[model samples]
Target: MSGATGAAPSDNPQDGERGELSIPSRRPRRLRTTPAMRNFTAETDLNPRSFVLPMFVADGIAEPKPISSLPGVVQHTTDSLLRAVEEALAAGVGSIDLFGVPQEQTKDALGSAGIDPHGVLNRALADVRQRFGDDIVLMADTCLDEFTDHGHCGVLGQDRYGNQIVDNDATLTQYADMAVAQARAGAHVVSPSGMMDGQVRVIREALDAAGYADVSIMAYSAKYASAFYGPFREAVGSSLVGDRKTYQQDPRNRRESLLETELDVAEGADFVMVKPAMPYLDVLREVAAASPVPVAAYQVSGEYAMISAAAANGWIDGDAAILESLTSIRRAGADIVLTYWATHAAKLLRQGR
Candidate 1:
């Protein structure tokens, strides 16, 4: 019988041993029912377009040499690099940041080879530009660490107390030349990753003066001095005996990133980046929110190495972890992610996995 209020009557105890259940009126699980639904509801635009593959091209290598530290990644010869680029393009990765591994014999204190037109990096840039034209966004690593025998980002000098230090002012001159050379070789973007102060202004002025006014600058605005760069050191064959704590940001500082980012943007950086993305997602988030231009994060070599090793040991699902890592970075607000797994992840995304 209905009451005066006309509400439904409660269930009789005779219907079941358990009386009545209280169901939630606001169930959030409605959106979690299917993979299609989840994908449709995804907040972040995680796709192939978000990745920027970082590739290494070595000088004087007859064959592609595998990097033991970075599993499944190789230092490609010019021919192998083209093939790799083709594969990346086929997989829907449209951008690549190139790093050149020069021969040890070419190393010099001033890293003058980095500015030479025939240097390994410039040669690869020219070749890729010629082969692909505007089919891809070619980025060059505009730093001297790889070319300098001392393994510092800049030329070394002594402080008043005779303590060896990076010559920040001298390095800017080198960076200006390096940026122009990369631009001449047809790099669409030149990334100044040495963490030198005023680098963005110097490079911008140089690029404009050289008539490559359209070339973009991707400044490493919040690069940290993390120990996680060990694998990258091996990949680039760095010859440093000490650390780069002097230039790179300290891991302990969070607000420091905003300061660095503000300066880069003010100095005309087209894009600013945070290195070793996973460990510094907080910093990435802050920079992304504050920056006027697009922000990028690097999924550095050590991050890749640890994940690959754990996956190889059957500790985790490699494919899922890769996507999750990238997704996490995207969620943290990075517009572009520089990863070693760009091509592989692109393929997986196409497969809808």
Candidate 2:
């Protein structure tokens, strides 16, 4: 029966002599086949209006001082700050985040200058508001790190062991006062970047009681104690003697971001932000999904400087990298992006290049 053979094999016509057909059915590149198609089908869009530029204003400077670590960024005098704002407006960027560089003499235990009506930040806010005339969204950085002598985000006190610890509750009072001062100075939004517990709620109450119910609060919901912030310390002349590990989140933790975001949302934050965006895209996505308000991501100084440094060395194409990084942040669910490249990016976006 085996020798009889059950059947005869026949050559298939489709295979021909090569035993293969050259039809390509799985063409993923069809979606990207043309520039028009690519542009039309882009999942995320980056625009100048969605960007907020962070600016530094020093108290007594007659001229803008360049920050060496953050190339193209500067600590501006009040006049220079106004000029920068004008440039930002012309570029179609409608928002600016202001950080004040106070004189070293004014720093103290309670950061009392933070609440002073005549303080650096307060004065700068007034100047910007008056100069811009409500055309721009003026945001004030509501944190004590720049104002405190000890350079902790909160008030410092001695523990039982006599080691210095941040006095969180006491600091909340100072934050509330600062919030009021910023609002009085005409800030459209007061951003609490201190990562202190109950800060949003405290600031909200203070603003409302002071008849500043219109002012918004942006909370730094998940700020990690990352080494990436080194350039930022230099930009603001931060006097921090020790790491913020005791207060800021550990870089190793992922779930903590959600917890912090949830707390900020419940505490009356008008918006929640993920700082140092490049390193925490997962956290940004999770927080964005859970937030009822808008989500913002800060492409910090280190992120900008690194890219610029690499671009300068010809290691990467700066233009492509900048757009790609910003697009990634937007795709990850950030409605707003704060970056040192805001003005340049805005100009590029406007030119349709």
State which candidate has the highest lDDT. 1
Q: Residue 109 lDDT in model 2?
A: 79
TM-score for candidate 2: 0.93
User: In candidate 2, what are the lDDT values of residues 266-320, reduced to their tens digit?
Assistant: 9899999998899999999988888899999999988998999999899999988
TM-score of each: 0.94, 0.93
**Could you give candidate 1's per-residue lDDT for residues 1-353 as a string of tens digits?**
44589967754323334656666667677888898988788798677777899999999899999999999999989999999988988898869999999999999999988999999999999999999988889999999999999999998998999999999999999999999999999999999999999999999999999999999999999999998899999888898889999999999999999999999999999999999899999999999899889999999999999999999999999999999999999999999999999999999999878
CA lDDT, every model vs. true structure: 0.93, 0.90
Model 2: number of clashes? 0
> Which regions of candidate 1 deviate over 4 angstroms?
1-21
List ranges where model 2 is wrong by over 4 Å.
1-18, 22-26
Clashes of each: 0, 0
Worst 10 residues of 1 by lDDT: 10-19
How close to the true structure is residue 34 of candidate 1, measured as C-alpha lDDT? 93
